[model samples]
Structure formats: C-alpha cells, structure tokens
Target: MIHENPPLLTRIRPWVFVFDGPLAVGLALLVGISLVTMYSAASDYDGRMFDHVRNLSLAFVVMWAAACLPLPWMMRSAVPLYLLGVALLIAVALFGDIAKGARRWLDLGVTRIQPSELMKIAMPLMLAWWFQNREGVRRWYDFAIATVLLLVPVLLIARQPDLGTALLVSAAGLYVIFFAGLPWKVIAGGIVAGLAALPLLWSVMHDYQKHRVMMLLDPTSDPLGKGFHIIQSTIAVGSGGIWGKGWMEGTQAHLEFVPERTTDFVFAVFAEEFGLVGNGVLLLVYLLVIGRGLVIAASGASVFARLLAGAITLIFFTYAFVNMGMVTGVLPVVGVPLPLMSYGGTAMVTLGLGLGLLMSISRQRRLVQS
Candidate 1:
C-alpha cells in the first residue's frame, strides 16, 4: 500500500474546493486590511488586536463550516432556524440582560447571545424558503405574507431598541422579496407611505434615536455630547485628504480623537490612515465580493438559493454603506459596523455565516453543472 505523496492541491482540494475562489480571495483581502487597520487603531488598548485576531479566526471557522453544509440541508433547516430565532427573540424580550440601556442580549447561563443577529440571516432564509415554495404561482398576497414574516422579528428587534439590527434584518428580508419579484409600484408606494409616516415614526422613536437624527443634521449642536462622535469621525475622515496620513501616522486615531476606533468608527481610522485611495481599494474589494455573490445568486440551483444569496449580498452592501456614511457624517449614526472590518464577535459570526451560505450556493451550482 506504499505510495508516493499526493500533490499538494489534491491533498487540500476538499478544503479549498468548499469555497468559491473569488469570494475567498475578496474576504482574505478584507481580513488582511482589518488586521492592519486594527493594529493601528487598537495600539493604545492592550490585547485588543489579539482579541480581534481571535474573533476573526472564529469567524473564519464558522464560515468554513457553513460553506461545507449541503444546500438541501440548509433549506431543510431554514424553518426550524427561523422559528428558533424568533422564539429566542421573544425570550430575550421577556427576560434579557440590559446593557448600555438596550436589552439586546439573552444570558444563556454559559454565555450571552444576541438573537437579533440570528435574524440577520434567518429572516432572508425564511422568506427565501417561503417564496421558493410559492414559485411560479406567487400572488400579491404572498408578498404580504412575506412582509409579515419579515416584520415580526424586525419589530421584536426594534423593540429591543436595536434599530441598527432591525434595519439590517429588514433590508435582508426586503432584498429577498424584491428578488422574488416584488412589483415596482408596490416598492414606490411603500417608499411614499414610509415618507408619509415619518412624523409618526419620529414620535415613536426613542429620544436617543431622535438625537442621532438631529446630530446628523448638525453635529455642532452638541459637540461635547451626542454629536461628538459624528464630529470627531468626520474630522478623521476629512483630515486624511488625498494620500492619507500613511498607516500608523493617523493623528486622529493616535490622538484618540476618533470615537469607537475599533468598532463602528473603524472606517474613520481606516480613512484617516489610508485616505481616499485606500477607501477606493477597500470599496473595490467589497464590490468584488458583492459581484461574486450576485453571480452566485444568478446561478443558484434553486429559487430558494437565489433569493437567499441575493439578500445576503445586499446586506453586505448595506453594512458597508451605512458604516461609511455615518463615519463621514453623511448619514445618521446607526451603530452598523463595516463588514469584515469592525471588531465584534457577534456581528463577525453573522457575516461569516452569510458568506458561508454564499459559498455553499456557489459550490452547489458548480456541482450541478459538473
């Protein structure tokens, strides 16, 4: 039974083949950027860079496991996962730990979990599954039903006062519905209706949420208070100018002027260090990843896979756009993190799962064609 050693690629094909090539490369680039940016941003905080590495490693493993799962199995588990997520969200609402004035985490004896993060993936999954089952015979009311499915968890998350997660979940589900053939008029009407309901929405919003919007309108109104974040972050971004401050030389980050340097405002650190050119490169990588996701969705093996892949792809876009917009003071701060760039375990894990699902869909398409 003695034999010569197998070629290196042959030995690793099973592992390597599990991921889509372009998507893997795009993620690797982002991960490398995250490490480099975090090193500078977390220089004053001992062990923060190490913790980021650990979080990234966990995210990579989660993504790999998700990529290995069969598409049929993913579809089969969709309903149960969605139900479990909703149940956990309900439980969190009933008896969750309040942290930073928001009840978003459920203490599960051993560790705490954010059920809303689960909805970021589960919402799209459930909706995709629903639309897939109704393919070729979908009615307008089917969209209505899908909207209800989307809203239940969204309202729950919003009630947790995590507007950021709620918005992300809503975007994820809406993308699925749109790709599943939502009408243009309906979308137009929804937008108009949403605009009409602004006053009501404002009245219901928490005071802090209202403050964020006001700060967006004028950060100088409370420069030393709620508006400080937008003020400081915009300085970091604009200070970068054309060629950047050259890596670790970023004054805003080094001087601790940029708030949340390691998390939500990491983009400000990145922008200050790398400047507009670096932001362009980062955005290109994101676009490549997003383009690969769209390709996967277009070539999906089933309607379920298509809708899920498309929704997940757009969710990545939303994360990046919102984070950067807030950092640049163009949009209201909503606590959204830069995808694959921010330093947080729960969000990283959720993003990894979404990426993994994309890989699975991509790999499945290849398998069928082959």
Candidate 2:
C-alpha cells in the first residue's frame, strides 16, 4: 500500500494552529465590533478605517507569532527581555524625543519607539520568572526584591511622565506579586501607604497631571479647556441613555465635540452609538475574555505560566476599567486607550502580545493533557 502524503494545507496549517479557541473567538468578536465602531468614529471613513485595519492586521500577526513560542522559551527570555526594556527606558530618559511635552520616545535614526510599552509584557514575565526560581523558598525578602524589580521600571516610566503606561506597567507587576502569594496584611498596608502618599504624589505631579485630577472633580471649571474631554464625553455617554442615537448618529462624535474619538475616547463613541444595551453586550464580551484568561491562568502547567497568565488577564481589566472610567468622568483622564477598541498601533501590538502569551500558556496545558 502506498502511503499518501498529508494535504499541503494541513501541512502548512499546523504551524499556525496554536491559538486558544475561546480566546481567539473572543478576540475576533472584539475586532468585528471595533471595525463597525471605527467606521462611525472615523471622520474620513476610507483613511481612518484603513489605518485601523492595518494596525489590527499587524497586531494579529504578532499575536500568532507570540503564541507559537513554547512556555519554557518565554520563561527563559524573561530576564533578557526585561533588561532590554530597562536599558531602552534609560536611553529614552537620556536622549528621547519630546512629543506633546513628554519625553517618552526614542529616535534611533530609523524609527521612533516607546520602550515603556515593552514593560507591559516584560514586567510580568520577569516577576513570574523570579517567583518560579524561588518556588519553594519564597520569603518576605523575595517579595521585597520583586517589589524593587517592579519599581525600577515604574519609576523610570513615571519620570518620563507617561503616567498612563506607568500605571499599567505597575499594575501588571503588582498582579504577579499578588499571585506569588503576597500576604494579605502586606496588601492592606500597601493600600494604606498609597493613600497616605497621595499628598506627596500630588506635590510632584506635573501641572497637566494636577489639572486632570481637578477636572475629574469638576469638569465645568474649564468647560472648553482641559475639561473639554470629560465634559463632552460625559454628555455623549449620558445622551445615549438606553437605546443610543443609533450607529453613526452620535452628535458628539460626528459634530467634533468628542475629542480623541478614535483613541482614548473611543469608549465614549461606543457608548453614545450603542447605548446601555449595546454597552451591556460590549462589556459581556470583555468579561468573557477576562474569564477565559483567568481559566488559562488557573490551568497553566507551571507557576511561571500561571503567574504570567493571571497578571496579563488582570492587566486587560485595568485597561478597560481605567479607559471607561476616565471617559465617563469618574476617573482622571490618563490617556489610556480602550483595549482592542482604540485606534493605535503601540497599544494594539502590546495587547496582542499579551493575548498571545495567554494562548501559549493554554497551549502548554493542552499539550500536557494530551
């Protein structure tokens, strides 16, 4: 009997068949929603929509590439990746470009890059690796060392005054620390210390940062100045009520009242056009993704995989909550983009990497089972 070769498509497909099924489905759903919503948010339908599609395509490609890496490879890469991230951050601090008054980008004569975005992935990976190395001997000193590792990047990002990315990186690292069996008393003490340090934090904040806090408390103070974003976004959200003004019918967005409608304020556009019912559905999708990520974390085959997965999952929640809260005027405007919904390349790629890591962990679990 002649042995028939497997089909070409099947042979070619195995290399790309690495995603977690439910997570992939969830991401697809979000992307579909984003396309429809981007059409409405974009003033130039062809240009803006095309750019968004291009970024998303790149993001998906990155996600797939990330998913193909074995969990051990990822763990092994953590320290080197983190060290590179920190080195790049130091480079940014020394000779970075200034954009909108923030020194957060590095000009390498070829392209401009933000090193802080790397920490969004690197911080957790490094922390997970650290904890994994000390699996049986985790002690208070280990937690302290982890805190130092987490803080170095955070403080550097903050000095760059890219507070939004700093907050995200900090949260990602903290999640890892928490998952590594951090004490409840330590958590409570940290919360208290954070609260007590508010005065000092305020004193050191830049004028714009202070203004954002003030605006959150009273958006009407400036109306058309720094408060414009919060005021307009809140109007768009409130006017949508239950049923919304319908797709592409949001007066705030179409009339140019909603600033940054395609970026940080994309959630406002979504809320205005889709309304409460639409918001409910969108939130349900997010919840599904988060839930699936948590499941992957819980099912991970190793401590490193588990901690990294859990941290990345919670980071998703942080992005959504902070973006939505800022847009709704409940929180300060922190320039955080809505995950998978915003029109930006950096954030999209970063998030894609995160999802890809989750898929890798999930893939490892399945492989072990089989």
lDDT score for residue 213 of model 2: 96
With a 3 Å backbone cut-off (N, CA, C), the pairs that clash in candidate 1 are none
Candidate closest to the true structure, highest TM-score: 2
Model 1 — which ten-residue stretch has the worst lDDT? Answer: 12-21
TM per model? 0.96, 0.97
lDDT of 1: 0.94
Number of clashes recorded per candidate: 0, 0
